[model samples]
Target: MSQFPHPSLPSSVKEPWLAVNLSLFFPGIGQLYAGKIIRGHSLIITQVGLYALSGWLILSQIGNIFIGELLLITAFALSIWGIFDAYDCAKTANSPSFEKLRTSQKDPWLAVFLSRLVPGAGHLYINRLWFSVLFFTFFVISLLVQLVPILLKSLIFYHVYIASTIRRERNQLPILGMALVSILFSLIISLQIFFIKTHIADTHIIVTNEMKPTLQRGDHVIVDKQIYRFKSPQRGDIVLFSPPEPLQDNHFREAFIQRIIGLPGERVEIQNGRVYINSQPLEENYPQKLSQYSFIPITVPANSYFVLGDNRNHSYDSEDWGFLPRPNILGKVTKRFFPPQRIGIVSS
Candidate 1:
């Protein structure tokens, strides 16, 4: 007779590989499919909470590259643990020992709450002395470096640490208080994210090949909203702005990202596939597929900029709609954060 009797088993056997794939989509899903109800729920909650905390940190401090990178690494580690734990849970889903272990597990939500209330408290509650020490060490380093916000760093570390503990073993149902706190934090973070996106910094995806080699379709760039306040827009700077009046009539509602080719009060003309500013050949250094098109020389009005796409032949830029009003300029594209291999400063 099997240690786990047939009557106690799940209606359908869970496949280990399927569980891993499910966890890949989300941390707790695989455990749920494997019949670890409380465990699965805890994992899901932990993952979401960690993500919310990380997003809040990144958005609130858009200039902190170190914090952003550290949070990303923490997230990656959590994902790996989730995938492996899900596979293990599925493999032992029907085992008597696994059932015993599940029932004996501590409450993961309590751990999460303790961690949030005090740094390393969660790990200490679970008797993970090493993890507690490591978390404290990270807290100290964050304080010393002053590069990362200590509060956010502590939250991220504890979140990841608690998540790892939850993955290692099943947990009891979370307390009502824990659930309420989690929901409250998530709500607050969401509101802050909206405010930050509107007034601070945000990410945008390139959908058109207008900027080509410098910015290709599907490239993700970070737009700095505060830069223009400190310095005026300069030539060759890539900018994100709303479509000018003429183009708006054609249903061009979305903002366009292009390079500033002509500055205010400058004589701008395009001829023989080259741009001339004040009749002087503009020294072109960036990658662009220039088109041999001639445009009657025109002076850029005050408080306006003449912009053009890097992919000259295919772009619908100033050549089509006229100058971009200074007020329409939303922000400057400072960095490309996606396509890991191409991650770097987006310089002119």
Candidate 2:
């Protein structure tokens, strides 16, 4: 059993190695590792209680501006407290009081707690480099994944703040409005970036030899969802859009990049090898050879588009799948970035 300095004995145990100042930093943290479990638990509980109280105050909406400020301060203080607790516990882990206790018997609960609480950080203090690296890697990626979006959104919010500040009063309401605007802007921007980064509909290309000569199999393409956002998709503009009805079983749903040969509410027909929209022939410029064979066409409905592959004969586009909704439009192929020889802006 570890010897403790009792009231009757001369104080013989080495002075507490951890500075009392460190304990002041984080309540229960230092005490827990100092073989003072009761005190440490009390501190942790107290901090948690304060945090709960702060959360309640914010949600109550009683003078929210002041409540928000108080909550922020409380959170900041708790973070500082936890940090100091970690420092204190780390420094005194091998103090004299712990010397008589078998190293194996020393409670590592607090260490484990810290590890769980902050991942690699707690392990670093324990000198577990390998475990720390694993923890750090996982947490860093997770943090960056979350933080990047937040930061991007925050950037947008700052723009809103600048714009709104030009007219609004510079009082607390303006500040609150700015904060809310920033948050909303950040969310929208972050969502856009995330979707662009994650969704394949944002990018795709002709993978099969079907669309070759016009759009080569090896061509890498970008889909622009914003193309038809302001203006309607016009004839001859290459559009990337999902098919109204997908062919092939297990082909859940997929987007097709094709040229818009006919617009919504327009009578479209293919005779021999020519495309006529509203009985007028499509104006020419692109690889003219694709128009060598005629296919059946029908009038496109409102909010729908007629799409055809650059390699007209082989592409299974609107001719095979049906009209693409304007909302289905993902983007226009503005450029072809792969296969150096083919690297150029994809022309209409």
Show how many residue pairs clash in every candidate, following the order shown: 0, 7
RMSD, every candidate, angstroms? 15.7, 19.0
Clashes of 1: 0
Error of 2 at 141 (Å): 11
Question: Worst ten-residue run, lDDT, model 2?
Answer: 161-170
Give Cα distance to truth, residue 250, candidate 1, Å: 0.5
Against the true structure, candidate 1 reaches a TM-score of: 0.57
TM-score of 2: 0.45
- Candidate 1's residue-wise lDDT over 1-348, tens digit each? 112223544545554544664564578887997788999999888778777766555444244444565676787788789878887888786566544644555434346545655667777777777877888677767766533443544454336434544333223222232334444555567678787777778899999999998999988888878778889998989999988889888988998999999999999998898899999999988999877699889999999999999999899999988999999999998777777767666768
**What is each predicted model's overall lDDT from 0 to 1?**
0.73, 0.57
User: Quick one: best lDDT, which candidate?
Assistant: 1
Question: In model 1, where do residues sit more than 4 Å from their true spots?
Answer: 1-71, 75-174
